[model samples]
Target: MAGEDEIEGRNREDEQMHYNSTNLSSDWPFNATNDLTNTSMAMVASSNPMNNASCSSASMIDSFCQTPPTIWDHHPTNSQTLGAFSDLNMQNNPTTSSSSLGFRKGNLLTPSWPPPNSAIKRGGMFLPPPTATPTMLPHTLSQFPADSGFIERAARLSSFSAGNFEDMINPFGNVPESSMSPYNNRPVQGQPQEGFVNGFKSTSGEGSKDLPLPVDCGTNDGSQPKNDARQGGSGFSGNNLPGESEYSEGGAGGGGGQDETSDEGLGSKKRRRSDQDSDYNQVKRSPQTPNESTKNNTEIQQKGDKNPISVANKSKHGKQISQSSDGQKEEYIHVRARRGQATNSHSLAERVRREKISERMKFLQDLVPGCSKVTGKAVMLDEIINYVQSLQRQVEFLSMKLATVNPRMDFNIEGLLAKDMGVSGTLGFGADMAMAYTQNPSQLAIMQGGIPGLGSSSSDAVRRTINSHLMAIGGVYKDPNSQVPNSWDDELHNIVQMGLNPSSTQNLGSTTPSHLKAEP
Candidate 1:
């Protein structure tokens, strides 16, 4: 009995050791049970706010170890906790999960460079969806309301899932072989096998070589000839004429030649009919004069307008010629009359005369000192008269002083004239006077014969001429005190009066004046 009991005890010890080994081998069952219990407690806590707060500390610790916290785990434990983060969350409840997560609050609140609005947080990093298509994702994203941040984020994630990203920027650089495999191999819906670049097939693809040139979508207007031309990649300048077969002309051989000939005949008839129709259309479009209407019918009957551009140019040229002829036949000068001005011929002449006088006054105003500031014409004229009188008085005073200084006047007039001429032969008046006397003794004889019509004596004429000659010799000294009476003041005054009123000369008559008489 003791031996049997020892054997059974040894077996029991072996069984106990086996059981311990199995427990050490794996803890999956305990871990699974713990996960289930934690999930059930989380669901229960989510349903009841009071219960959640009681387990808040435990939940917070469990959250760290959670592989991925559920949507319920994302919810705040109490209303106060959620209310605290309400200002930070700008989205619906689903999106508020990321904002309300206490540990993730720093990342959610801290701003990113481009803003993290387009992306979602997963494992504390922004990640995109893995199965979205490049072609249709944008349209899908567009369907969501702009204010719905959660839907926008989800659409963006779906869009990122597609492998084909035509223009997306990847700041993370080349993706790893393992992580990229799922997206790279997966086919995207509604995306072309060969990618598109600006509506053209990407030349990088091998199949692009076989692809036909893209037809212009806008040019298909149901016109057979034009459609064929556009499809052939030629505009209106195709090698074959309007109705000829392009293929038949290009190495189509003798067999197609008969068909081409028959087609050519038919083409000629069609072209003739089209030309007639175009002529009718042109005639209808253009405005027709009586002469043009008659000529157009004749032209259409003989032959349709073959060259419409040349015809248009000819018509334009004819119009220009007629306009030139009309312009030459009747020329007009445009003259605009001001608001208060008269337009009659007599008034025009009077206006011109006033303008001439005004211009002369303006010129005199510039020449006279202290006259620039005077606004009234009458005041300016008065100033000018006073200035002229002052000048005349100064000349008389200087002449009187010259006479007083040289009382005897012993200087010979002829000798002074010769000396002045010799000193400066270039002096215009002295040079001319010298040349006159020297070159023409007859003129001197004529002057000595006396002022003929005036009936003055030869001696008086000689005295007058010598005195005039002396005055012409600018710097020469003269004496009114000897030989001639002192009538210098009278002669100067008379000359100034004549200059002031030129019409007074006619009234002065042909008689020799008192100033012309020399003292005997």
Candidate 2:
């Protein structure tokens, strides 16, 4: 019934052509066969219920369908070969769905890249299809919901299922023997006996002498994708193309039911691939699936991959003295060699600089979320405390180092009322020492927990430890007098009022500040 409808549509067209036998062929390269085929396809499409009403009305004037035929064999009385189709009214009359007409029209000339949405760029920006580009609002492709929908749909279709992937990634079935199969025995130079075979270089099982020239191969040339023979293969010979036998088959069977398969397959391939966004993935980098980054990192670690060689070497060097240490002795054995002391005074000073670089590296490592196992809590806290303490120690070390260099600088530290130590505490260093320590008191307290007090022996001892810790961190000399300077009482009025006496405290029950030695 469907085939009759198509035939009837063509008969109607031929009936009209009988009127004048118009030489549409003169203006168009397409001949009667082409016209007949187009008319049939258009009519078949118009038979759809959606197209009936429009085609019914349009059936009257459309030159391709309704115009009475002009002379098919001769030029029409009209001189202009194209004049027959110049009936723009007739052109507008064949009211089949514009979508179908457009598709046919576009594919009529040549099957092209899928519409912009379907035709994904192999490796560049996603251009809205040629059709859509002209109509699209000026914006990024992501701005279009329609394009996104097509992208998702294409992704859905193209996503290879495990089974499909098995097909694509591994075309031949099970492959223990594909590379060394019997087909590969291309023995040289003779049509060997029935059971014999030729190996790779031979043109046939008979071992022909001529070998075809090599062509561009893929990442896995001889080893993979033999199924993509259309793209070319390492060993396939042109003997595969049919010559005499093909024509004989066509003459005998009128083109095998299967012979048409090539054309049909090509057509189907075009139609299948013409979807909107076929090359979308090609143009874009394949995004890692969720969890992919973590998975890849985990796999690498499990495989025991190490840092690049140079990096591995540097790490080994840093760890060498410790790794080779016998017990903690040599490892903790702080080298007291003063070779670099002028540049960086103490053993501790050099260690602190190394620690700072290590801490920064840890910070960088923590930037990647799942890539690291470190929470950084303990390490970070230790780094902060250690850094602050080092700054404090460096301040004190400079003071002592300067005392040896210049003595005048101490005056600025706390207005040293009496010249205590000169030559060692020269005019030059006193000011520098004070600026280093007391000028930034807030910073000092934040480092040491609080300022050093001078009330009792225990209080003095605590002050000494704080300064000792500072000197250790900074790689400087710990003063034997790490205690708060005994002159604290004389230097500040507040300290004097607080009193070094220690006697008034226990008996204060009867005396508040109000009851103290009134007015002098």
Candidate 3:
């Protein structure tokens, strides 16, 4: 449990960090200090003449127009002009376009340029050297989307630093190192010392003025690029920017006061331009770089594997859950006999239960004090069943005594058992005779120990009536002839006839032999 909690906390912290990072990255474009400002402003200048007029009106210096006139010659149109000039020169001299004009590209310059643009470097990638950095090369690099192009350019620069040249290649499968390597089998050393190979200011023993800058970076001199290409390795020098030109001419309206822009506007514009220049620098300076973007993506994906829940997901079921009562919630497993069950258990059952409970509670109250404050219903329900059983046995004995005198009296001892006990009553012949004896002293004395038989009774009430009759049977019998009570017949009966004493029914007179006659 603790380990899970720890892992959860760590995951939350990581998620929070990633969220913040994402927000920051999104807002980055707004504060982008590395946008190609010079290119944007140059485009903006053409679109809104007000911007141009505002700048020129205020005497804003043209920073983008800072390069010299010769740079224009690097343009294809300018090259056509130069070619025409050469043809014009041919008319003056029979020597030809060769000696007078310059060295032929085949004899010197390759008609096709050296060092391919990157894979992302498409349409208009190769620009006039006057454009300088690729991002700020011209206002017309639209082969890639703005964000994608900018990011790719950033990646291209990083690639240079990290020496990942292969991935940053031209569509034609050419990269910078492909042309730069001295040997076919050599791999890119990508080392700091190799910086000399690109014609940085490397020392050559003790002579030569600054190594003559083996490559021309357009702005390096006041000469045209074709003229600059005559030197060894100059045609495709690694150090030279792709479109190196000595200078670029400012157009007629360049920096002239006819434009309403001001000097202060130049700084702001240049500041914005400088930012663009840096962005371009990064693109042009690009070498093979690290796959940081991929690594960060993978980290985010792996982090997802570690943490599955999101704040939104956790809160999806926002309803609070609470129990309405301290009770169980369950499906009805059984459906009982509704009102019938209630009716079956008579109200008397409740009364009896109350009695039992009262008894138990009294016992409990005595056994344990204040702790057992039994409710009345509970106390009444808590009966000792054995006590009820004993009472039933006594009632059964009394019932039997009544049954002896009457066989029809169907005594149900169990039913008679006071309802609370949940038991029926019982009966015995001896108890019935004893009950009869209790009702009459003389009859009881005559047949005190003898048992009597029973009579018919259909139901409980009838049986009770018969039992009552048995009790009376032991007493006097009213004679039909007189209102007088004769001496009671002590013997019960000889030949049984209803209500006549068996001992008194026989007649003895002198109508027979002397032995059978009465002795006088």
Candidate 4:
């Protein structure tokens, strides 16, 4: 009995240990009761002794362990205590148990553990069906209305079935046909239609009665009376032609007579008689006719005169009258004239002068460097003025520079005149000096007075001294023809036709005295 009890106690200990090792908590993702039952069964099976005499007891233990415990299956004495303890644990870890059982606040229908929102209908007797109140879904999902009526109508409309598609695509299938095109078919009145010939009405006899007959259609016999070739073929010198009598009778109420004559003669006689009558009436009624007729007769007589002087005088008077009238009109009238001036001798000469000036200006413009390309006279003049001013400034600057380099050198006018007079008296350099002066007066002036220490002397003394110096330097007496020295001063004067430098005077004075003594 003692051994059995000891064995039983040992087995119970082993079972408890295994149960503790495999026990399930509220965190397990399944039913806690089932987990606990399985863990207890495993503990009983593994902990039971195989050769022990309490095999039946082991079996009973396994069965008891396999039977899952409910919340109500605790010991009778400790039920209330265990229940309180479980309630405390649930309060403490509500999320753990709720998560494990897949129950949440807003998602009672679809729990977190299972695949969400399956097609399965879950409502039963214990749970009422979920009422679908209009919840605001995302815009991406609910672009259309949620009403079933609208959705059904839209679905019907959007359906791609053959009948619906054909109806939608062929909306005009029931339209009636027409025999004619939409454009108008009738021709417009009075307007020329396509492929139709437009004929014009004849206007041959529609002319005004006052209009004269055409010359080409009229007979020449009466309209243009035959000329007398013997009398210079003058058409006016003909008798028995339609003239004053026909015109007077026609104007004086002789309609019957004209009609009879017109029938007897051709259309020419009718036109000529009408024309003569009209002319005679006009001439007889005009107030100025007598004066005009006299003037015309005088003009014809003067034209036929054989006096050359009279003709010439008449022509000259006509020209004078025309010119005087034109001049008076031009002087008084404030009208703007056209482009070119009136043609006359004075205007022609002025035009020629202007042309010549323009040509000369063009030539000058081409000759000058850096001139403006524009052809305006003002612009050309401006550019030329600027260029000349710049050249003058350059010359002044160069002169200043030269003067600074040789401050003792003189360029006085008096000294140049003295030198020129001396050279003319001694060497007869009148032509050469004048030519040099004409070519470059400024340079010639500068060169003539460029000698050193000559600015202090009077014009006469300077002249005499310069002439003697030239004669001595050239080893020549008072002779017109002499061999000149091949000296630097002579070479410089020959090359530039200018005076020698003042510095050469010292060398020339030293050598010139010796050459003078040797020549004598």
Candidate 5:
């Protein structure tokens, strides 16, 4: 009986040890899940039962025990199940406890499944190895792919010095060496490009209906233009500008070539621009010389040359311009002749002279009174002469009168002329003379009208002569009869009467003495 008890104890110990080993192995990387691992361990234990008593005891215990939570459970099985198993297993074997191994608070809440190094095999498919969480990083230019062309261009640009700035910005086809080398067969800086020249010819025959007609800007020197046979391939260079010869030549060649090609079933002359051509164009924007300017201008004019009518019109227009310019340098009135008038040079000269003379006569008529209505040139001349003679007589008479009135010559002539002469009364002249002269004998010749007929200059000579005669007459002539003669009074009265008549001024050469006659 004691031997049977020993065997049963040994069987119970083996069962407890197997249960602990299975629980520990469930946490191993090789296990699929806790449930599958526990099921396999239960089958092994059931297959290896060595004692019936021990097996009966284990069966009774297994019947009372609940299943442990698996790794696949999103939330662990309730802690109440673990709490119930905790009391039975905590005392003897803590490693086999569900709470301590699979259902720990930290493991259940934040479970990391399928370790990073392991692959998950579910059904027929195998999952890729678990990856670590991704992290963000700052971006940089180096992270992108590099372009060789762009890099080389940048390096070349950085290498340029201040001295080469002109080369960089040059706009007349003076491209830099680096930019020009790649495009084969491009023309040099001062030379015209073959492609451009060919293109010019191709387009020349194709009439530019949309473009405006070019203006004729003739050469600086007015010399006649000479034809360049080399420029006009067809040997027709009529009045072309300096560089237009080449343009004409190109147009003739292109037109003939195009015609021949079309007749022979050859291809068209059109060409597509390649990369090299485009690059060349970009580099060809530099400045050009005078020769190049002429070439370009020729190209521009070629399109207009196709139409013979237009060429003829241009030639006609050019001739008109030259004629007009020549006319500008000469001195000639642009006078148009009337139907009845002569257009001869002599007639024109005579008419111009007559016009000048008529203008002078008009001016003279304004100066001379009563001559404005006179139309005849001879009559106007006669009136002008008479008027001048009258002015001369009036001047002479006035000078003589002044000499008599101012014997001292020191009297203020300006003050005397400003006051009224008061010559209407019979005694007016005598009263004025008496007041002016202090009994001076120098005034006697003037009052008696004894001055000689020495012409218009006689008054000036008499005035100067009177200045030398300063002798004073002491006594006044008390006899009024002696002061002025009866003949003198009669003469003075007649002179005054004639002067008062406005009509007497028309003929100063009338019978009345001119010197004695007061100016009308």
Candidate 6:
């Protein structure tokens, strides 16, 4: 009976120990298999009545209790099973517990899952929740059988979450460098890694020394450079290297490439410039040797003879003067100089353009019939304006006149003038009669009374009336006394005789009048 009681007590102690070990192992990072094996051993020891009587069970129990728990146990179960168990535990306890050996707040034990979509706001991503309760998996099961589908799904979720998290953290990492700003130091696509050139380092052997250093050319405070005085008050002396001659010639020819010297030169600089000019003059004035002068004269003559107009144009654009230099005659083209005044290239261009416009204006002035010949630009412009206005008014008046004219009339004033001026044979009588009426209407009155036919008498009455109307409108008439018989009477007699002669009117049959007989 005492043995039975001892056995019961031992069993109770073993059960308590098993329970404690299980709790400890679960709390620890160790797997469930190790805890289950330990519980099985304790149960086996407690179940044996001989071990309890001999004290082996207590010793064995002590040994089992003394064994340290490992983070992961090398169980006899399949690796896939262990992996699944580990994964489930990780999911349940994302963060280590306080009782865990190296556990600390904010420290992550397992790979983190992605935050919910609500974490993103505006253009920026919001911070994730401070703490998250991991979803717990089953712990009672000693071994977990692997599920290929679940494993694959979990893997895909992990990868997708990881990639999304990476993108959120460093969004520009996958973008092409070319799409980035020029100021960004990211490497360009298709460019070799080693081909990058550092702006700080120079390509020349002298390095930075070979680089052109920026000089203090001028200041905004109106303070000039210290060396400006030495350079004859010029900011840079190099500008004058082309010399004054080039500047003068370029200005006249209206060509580019003229160097504009600084206008801030001192009085001493002006004196030096004058001295140079005098020296140039002296050099130009010296007489040439006979042979050289003859050769030069012959060349000039040949060139002048070839194209006199070209020489004349050059002289017109700019004055070319023959000067003797170093005992040799030299010709220098003289051009107007601005002299110490800063001139813009645009101003030079504008001047040339104005000159061309002036030439064109002159040509137009010559063509215009009574445009008041004027020299002043303002006066000429006023004349041109007035002339254009007058022409416009004339055009309006002529258009109104043409509109009022009878459209039924086929007669053209120009055609009439042309016909009258052309042949003087078959149509000569009509032309001559028209001219006679135009020149003197009084002459028509004299010819009217001379006609014998009834048609002629009626025509004479119409002519007298027309003449009287023309005289009323201030028409000029030649004096009857001033008219020479040879000029008027002879032509009229010939015309009358030609019309009256029988032989000349052979085609006129018997209807021809005998009272209109010629007095030959």
lDDT of 1 by residue, 56-101 (tens): 5225534432211221232333223323433211112112222223
- On residues 212-309, what C-alpha lDDT tens digit does candidate 4 reach at each position? 11111121111110010011001111111232233244332222122112111111122233343244223322323233323322342232211111
Evaluated at residue 500, the lDDT of candidate 2 is 21
- Candidate 2 structure quality by residue, lDDT tens digits, 450-472: 21222222533433443343345
lDDT of each: 0.27, 0.24, 0.22, 0.27, 0.26, 0.25
Candidate 3 or 6, higher lDDT?
6
Instruction: Give the distance in Å from residue 41's predicted Cα in candidate 2 to where it truly belongs.
Output: 3.5
Worst 10 residues of 6 by lDDT: 122-131
lDDT of 1 at 61: 31
Report the C-alpha displacement of residue 476, candidate 6, in angstroms: 21
By TM-score, the candidates rank as 6, 1, 4, 5, 2, 3
TM-scores across all candidates? 0.20, 0.15, 0.14, 0.19, 0.18, 0.21
Which residue pairs clash within candidate 6? 283-325, 284-324, 285-324, 286-324, 287-327, 288-327, 288-328
Steric overlap count per candidate: 2, 47, 59, 1, 7, 7
As a whole number from 0 to 100, the lDDT of residue 187 in candidate 2 is 10
**Could you tell which candidate, 4 or 5, scores higher by TM-score?**
4
Candidate 3 regions with alpha-carbon error over 4 angstroms: 1-44, 47-68, 76-158, 163-520
| Model 5 lDDT per residue over 327-407, tens place | 321211123223234433356457778888999989999999999999898999999999999999999999989788787
lDDT of 2 at 189: 6
Clashing pairs in 4: 247-277
Q: For candidate 5, give the lDDT of residue 465.
A: 31
